[model samples]
Target: MLPTATGRIERLTLPETDQTVCGRIALVFPRTPVAAAENPPAQDLVRVGEVRRICGAQLRNWGLERFDDSVRLLLSELVTNAIQHGSGSQVGVRLSHTPVEVRIEVRSGPVNTLTARDPGLLDEDGRGLLLVDALADAWGVDDAGWVWCVIATAAHGA
Candidate 1:
């Protein structure tokens, strides 16, 4: 069992696979409490905001202001997408940084598949992944509902 931000105890069933991309490791976390299946907390948005604030501070500390806007937008899009489309109550986000790159990952409950679609010019939605693809140095999705991307720190002289 793990403690949530709300101080509630919840269980997680992580996958055994140890995957690496761009020198960053991938971690899979189960969605929130399975018992209260239907009434999942709407904490994803709050978490996204928290992550943005944290990343913003970290970027400032690292002198990577050039990438701050991109990181904020990409993270927000990925987390929002997971909360809206994924099939679980909880979401997990991980950020790992190395000398050369920073990796961002968002994991959620079971999802049938992850795909990027082209949105009509008039459509307001369906552009999240497109933005991610454009901004991220590398990005992909796994069968286990893990979506990740990497940003090159070297680009910002970090």
Candidate 2:
């Protein structure tokens, strides 16, 4: 099934204007938070809480609250995909906040074989990107051999 969706990203000014913030990651790890961790988040799941907490912090963060659920959900999927599909080193989670939009970049070395999930109607096997595809305004893969997703702050979640 074709699962790609089209959405709007703010104008990307050229000539040297691909705005971005690149974060380097290592064999990092995070302990599952007491109540919030749905699964045993990978070793490098530290960014999950940081991103989640930052999404609901103060005014600026509170604004993220609107998009927080899908943001966090997509974030976890990207991270898990990296760990499961990319080399088991570390994954990079970059939250790009521009004047007109917000985007997430997850960078990781790819695996020799990729395993896509099977979202059975009643089976909770693989429904990662399905959620991302359905919720995010736009989501896709990138050149760095990583997965990226973008959603409008206003689009949030149910």
Best candidate, TM-score? 1
Q: How does model 1 score by TM-score?
A: 0.70
Q: Give residue 157's lDDT in candidate 2 (0 to 100).
A: 39
Q: Give the alpha-carbon lDDT of every model.
A: 0.66, 0.51
Off by over 4 Å in 1: 1-44, 111-113
Number of clashing residue pairs in every model? 0, 1
lDDT: which candidate is best? 1
TM-score each candidate.
0.70, 0.58
For model 1, the run of ten residues with the poorest summed lDDT? 20-29
lDDT of 2: 0.51
User: Cα lDDT of model 1 overall?
Assistant: 0.66
Error of 1 at 11 (Å): 16
Clashing pairs in 1: none
